[model samples]
Target: MSADILNSLARRVGDGVAAVRPAAAMADSEATDPVEAVATALLGYVSEPGDGVLGRLVGALGASGMATALLEGRSGRDIAGQAVTGLGPADAPSGREVTAGLARWGPRLEEDAFARSIAQAARVGARLLLPGDGDWPEGLDDLGVHAPLSLWVRGRPSALAERPSLALVGARAATGYGEHVAVEAAAGLVDRGLAVVSGGAYGIDGTAHRAALAAAGTTVAFLAGGVDRFYPAGHEGLLGRIVETGAVVSELACGAAPTRWRFLQRNRLIAAASDATVVLEAGMRSGSLNTAGHAAALGRPLGAVPGPVTSPASAGCHRLLREFDAVCVTDAAQMAELVASVGGGVGGSGDGDDDAMTGAPPPRRLEMLSSAERRVLDALGTRRSRPIGDLVRDTGLTPGAVMGALGALDATGLAARSGEGWVRRPPDEASVRPGSWS
Candidate 1:
């Protein structure tokens, strides 16, 4: 772990006690002295300095606006505290100055207990990422003071900078329409080469991840808890696949369990990291609404998939469209188009740009298949999978046409049957490499 990571861990520990207790665990402890409780907690880590490191650190941070500087690993600098405070501009440091500062502080912090705590977390599958690392999403910087000093990633490291990323958030106790919308939006985002980002909670978030993975598109699960202890425990397998293909990210250090406060904090990262954020379905009081709010606050383009007006699960999205002015997206093409209109445009994956469907060669072989077969296979490209019925409906073809497509899909190794008669196939590897198919 780096010094920036160590400082971030310390900050998260301090903030945890300062914030409201998690909703799931606040049983009649409201009468306790909040400051005393926090101080007592601090004692368990730092040796009792008269003024206390936490207090001094907070003061120093306030004076120098040291949060961003800390992320930059510029701790040893003696800049005027007034000038450094609150996202202020500064003289660019020479390469030598940066190198010297890191060289001095790196080893000292490495042996510190706080650093060890973060390291322990990493040992058990957690990852620590600062602003410049591969796992760091530049969008988080938009959070300003609320931005995490370092993100503690539980699952996939590749998710940090993965392109074509969009956030899918909604209520955990989602309605069937909400669930269906979540799956559709997620799969559509993947088909366009974007990764789906969401909190690894039960309802909409889980659906998004599952759909993205099923489509062979990347999906990122941003957790509020330590990576070692997957929250909702039921989604452990889902988290596993995300780590394999995308990533799970956080701001807390290792061993930091999930709490309600962390969930809100985690929301900011999801909002800021993506080029755009989509609320597939959410209730008026849904936690997903928090993410949507954060995205809008950051000036990130926000979208919602409309649902039945009767669904409480979709009320939040309706509110966004009605009150918050969120874009209404009906399909993947619009979602991708909206995301591209903002900054998180998808297509290239450090390999090559996504093929433009407009001028591509006419598919003679594909044309041989019935319309439904062609439609099903069309959706089964290099990223994700789709259900036969989804294809049937999406293509406006009959069930027989869908079935014929499935048969050709299996024969071509372009798709394979999976659970509940759904079929999935990743993009063909040969198409990605030169002359492989020939």
Candidate 2:
């Protein structure tokens, strides 16, 4: 019964089925409310990346609450009320924006999307990384409302922060000179204890990833689509190799196709996941500039390599250096200096400051579960049942708190009344991995 509610709602509209509450409890619900993980994943599936309205809504209501609210056909104004109640109106979406957001998400919210997503991911051995997980890349917290809610990683989660990472980005039609420079920079950054990060596109991105792998260094490739498909079709073998040594990551769920907007949004992730971003080579309107912009906005160090004035392939890099105040870097040492200049903080995990523009909280600020919920859920088991008294004794929580959590969990399909006491749901029941992995 972990994600059963979301599945059951495939045809249902709204009935206030799941209890709506704050999210801090859900964040603390690592093992307790298996559906909480599914709920969060469902939110991502229903909405587009960088949707500030949905992002803040999830932050206020908790993913479970927000998911329930959406599934129940709540109005945007009504849902926005949660933010007004919890985090205040600073970042709450306008009723109109929230309405538009719901309209955008409505069609995408499919039945059993979470179940099928996790199943496919499991087949590929990909794991889901929640915002507050041990393996989560904290640097992405800098994006505020625009950050990815969860990361689908197809390889080593450790690759994200094996050390501070540097994003080497540029045009796909990279020149020989640009490829040579990317290779040198990637290998050198690897030797200097920095992981290499790039979108798994051809030319510069592929070149850098290959160089880092060839040098036996950790590298991470951020994809616009699901990690399951490994976009660009031609890079299948390359991505597979990364799965063996590093990681291939995405924000999209398994089986979701990539779009142009997703690719652009994916650039922000590339910039956010690393300590610094460098445009090895790009044309005048190269997409790497998008990555550089995100790095600059995030306060991550930005660098651009110089090239011959006559080479149109180098136009974007020169423009970045000239217009965006990006640093001029020609060699790997210079690029390493970009990472060094910023104290080597990956993903810009700065102090707890709300975003100036969007008013989004620091990373994972949107995901929270009450302490009582945490204790109660922690005490429940999927197969074995525990009575109220046993739970109070095991968790040291008051009977009232335990009972309240159980009620909330039961309402959300996290826990259920067994023959005697209580037991967790089907998320982790009889499955090799937790329901959230889906």
**lDDT of all the models against the reference?**
0.58, 0.73
lDDT of 2 by residue, 1-438 (tens): 424656565324222112111133235435234456667777876665776777788788888888888777788888877678877877677777777666656655566555566667767777767776666788899888778888888878768756688999988888999999998888888777788999999889999999989988899999988988988899999999999999999988788666544666788889888888898998865667777777888888889999999999998788887877888987877787888787774342222111132211111110233545644665577899898877764444446657888898787677899888999874433322211000
CA error at residue 106 for candidate 1, angstroms: 22
Q: How many backbone clashes does candidate 2 have?
A: 10
Every model's Cα RMSD, please?
Answer: 23.5, 18.0
- Superposition-based RMSD of candidate 2 using all C-alpha atoms, in angstroms: 18.0
Candidate whose TM-score is highest: 2
Worst 10 residues of 1 by lDDT: 352-361
- After TM-score superposition, what is the CA distance of residue 395 in candidate 2 from its true location, in Å? 46
Model 2, runs deviating above 4 Å:
1-32, 345-438
Against the hidden reference, what TM-scores do the models get?
0.57, 0.73
- The sequence of per-residue lDDT tens digits that candidate 1 reaches over residues 96-141 is 3433433322332322445455446635655444444544577776
